[model samples]
Each structure stands twice: as C-alpha cells, then as structure tokens.
Target: MSAKIRLYVDHLLGPGQSVELTREQAHYLFGVMRLAVGGHVALFNGKDGEWLAKVAEAGKKGGKLTCQTQSKPLHMPPDLWFLFAPIKKTRTDFIVEKAAEMGAARIMPVQTQFTNSERIRQDRLQAHAVEAAEQCGGTFVPEVADLQRLDRVLDDWPETRQMMFCDEAEVGSALRLAAQEKGQPWAILIGPEGGFSDRERARLSGLPYAHVVSLGPRILRADTAAVAALTMWQQALGDWL
Candidate 1:
C-alpha cells in the first residue's frame, strides 16, 4: 500500500522529536482520516526534504509523529513566477493552488489599474500554496508574495528573466510565444478581469523582457488565463520541456 502523506511546517524533525500538527491538520488526521497510532505517513517542509514518519500517538485534539527516514531530496522548480491581479477570494485561492500545482517558484499578486480586488490576505494564500504542494507530492512550496503594484514589479524586473504577458487583445497563437521563450528563466503574467489599462499594456509591451502572448481565440477569465499561460510556459521554457 502507498504511504499516507502529511505536510508540516515545524522544524527540528528527527528520530526522537515530537512534531505537533496545526488544529485543522489535526482534525483531518485524527478525525477525518482516522490515522491511528503506528500508521505510517510522509511529511515535508518547504525547507527540509520529504521524510518518512510514523504516528507515535493519536489524540482527540492532535497527534505526535516520529521521523524515520528521508524519502526525497528537496527539489525546487525552475525560476518561474506567476504574476496576476488579485480576484475574488475563492478565485484567488484557486489561482494560488493551481500555481503551486503547476510548479511556479513564486506567486505575486499585482495591483493593476483595472484590478477589481484591492485587499488580499497573504497568509491565507500562502496556506493554499502549502496545501497544494503537499497534495501534489512536491518537496518545495512556491513563495507567496504580498500584494504589490504592477508598476513597482515592472520597475524591479530582473533583466535575465523574461516575462510572458498573457495579452487578451493579442491575436497571435500562444505556441509562437512559447517557442520564442525557450531556454530562459521566465514569468507568466495574467491581467485583471477588466484587463490591463491602455497605459499599462503599452508600458509592458515596451519592456525588453516582456513578450505578449495570446491563449487562443476566446477570451478567458483571469483565473483561466493564469492556468493556460502557465501550461504553455511549462511546456516551453519550464521543467516539462
């Protein structure tokens, strides 16, 4: 049988240390999953590599586990960032989850001129990324960044990394951009629901590292655009290549 997987953020895991789970994690393990004493599980931290562990004790509130052995080395994906304007709460969570699953190294919430959502809970988004990584058997979790203005992110753009701008107004095919972006550190940018302002689009188009791409004929929602853009990027310039 396959070993059950459980992720924890606590440090100092080893043979004799007792690791405490968060309240929700405890509920899932002890209540929902009914993991009992002596059951085996796998765990990982954003820092340490994955470890094989066993439940030492199970309680109503929480449980204790002992690390037994290392399962996989800590591996991070290629330098790919997902920059998107924040949307509704559930949609934002979905974006973060999908970004982690798709292997983005960093997730940035950009505040664009036409962006509808202004306030974002970074902690909650980070939690979603962690959960997604755990579910996907990933050793590393993507870093969730706090909300920042689009202009500032552009101003501080790294010269070496290319940016694939998912421009809805563009009529060209996504594959063209994908082929051109091969063999370079890249980022995929998705605009807000209302799309990028004229000025913002013009500025982005003028950037040396920015390559505007289209995700086919139909206009996709901001959430769908993010996923499609990432898929194209992963197939072209990312680990999937």
Candidate 2:
C-alpha cells in the first residue's frame, strides 16, 4: 500500500532499520491517525531523504517502524538565510513555517532596535520548521537559530554572503533583485513591527554587502514583508525558477 503519512524523524533511516516513535509520535500515528500495525507511512530524517515504512509495532505509549525502501533522495534548499525580528508568538511561528516551506537554509530571529519582542522559543520554532518541511515535501529542515542582536550579527557577517535588507523606509526607491549576485549565498532581513529605527537603517545601508531594497509602494507588516521578500528572492535568485 502507498504511504500517506509523512513523518520527520531524527533517527537514521535505511532498509531494515527500525525507528522508535516518541510518545507524541505514537499518539499521532496510532492514537490520532489510527494507523494500525503493518500500515504504511512515509519517513525522512533530513539526512536520508524519504523512505516508505510500515508500523512494525504499535502501542499507546510508543511504537516502532521499520524502513522498507527508499522513496526520494535528499533535496537540499538554496544556501539562503532569512533573518527577522520576533513578533507575536503566532506570527513569528508563521515566519518560521513559511521560511521552511520556501527553502530557507537557515532561519534567524534578530533583536532589532525597534523589535517588538525580545526573545523566542528556539526549540518550538524549530519544530514548526520541521512540520512545514514535512507538509511541503522537503527533506531538509532549516535550522532556527536563537535570537541575536542585529548589530552584533552584522558585525561578524560573512563578507562573501550578500544581504538583502528590506527597508520599509525605502518604499519609493524599491528595486528588483535582478542585479544581485546569484552565485553567492544570500540572506534577507525583515524589520520589526514598528519598522527599523533610523540608526538601524543607516547601519544596514553602510554595510558593503547589504542592499536596502523597498518591498512596494505601500508598506507591509513585518510578517507580510517577509513572505514578499522571500518570494522576490526565490523568483529572482532562488531555486523557484
């Protein structure tokens, strides 16, 4: 039978290798999904691509599944980073999800001068990324980095990677990313709710590797701007086209 459930596991997957499901996984599969023993399920561990497996053992607390055969090979995303300030818990989670679905290699929460939130649950956000990857048919789950000060992050920024600074203040001056160096790694920065402060914008502007591009004529909320920026980047320099 064809496997319908796609699960993201942390264990290595290969023919004959059994994966022990966690308590939560057990509930999702047997308890909630009502998957019975010998039922098929799709699995991936980020490193091993996708595999078709069956429920070898089933229990309420936990269970086991053994890989039968490989389904798809590992598909890595572009070498891209999406850096944004933490907003409301749900919105921040949304950004993480979209980043994962859109093939961001790494997700980072930046502490901007005008940032609305000062901290984030790194583990929780990482889980969101995994869920997004599973639903979007991706093998690689991008890393959700801990909250860091924007200035500090820029201070040690790699000179080789290009940065797309989404400047809300540069609305009229907005330009497409067509001229960007597609061969190099890229990162997109989305500002906070109140937008980047004057000092923050100036600092980003002076950075040699940074390009201060506007999103559109009308301003967009931080979360919306993130989706817009990622779409533009993907269409222009990412793997989308």
Per-model TM-score, in order, reads 0.92, 0.97
Error of 2 at 151 (Å): 0.8
Most lDDT-accurate candidate: 2
| lDDT (C-alpha) at residue 122 in model 2 | 96
TM-score of 2: 0.97
> Candidate 1, residues 120-195: lDDT per residue as tens digits?
9999999999999989999889989999999999988899988889888887745465457456788889999888
TM-score of 1: 0.92
Clashing pairs in 1: none
lDDT of 2 at 14: 99
On TM-score, the candidate that comes out on top is 2
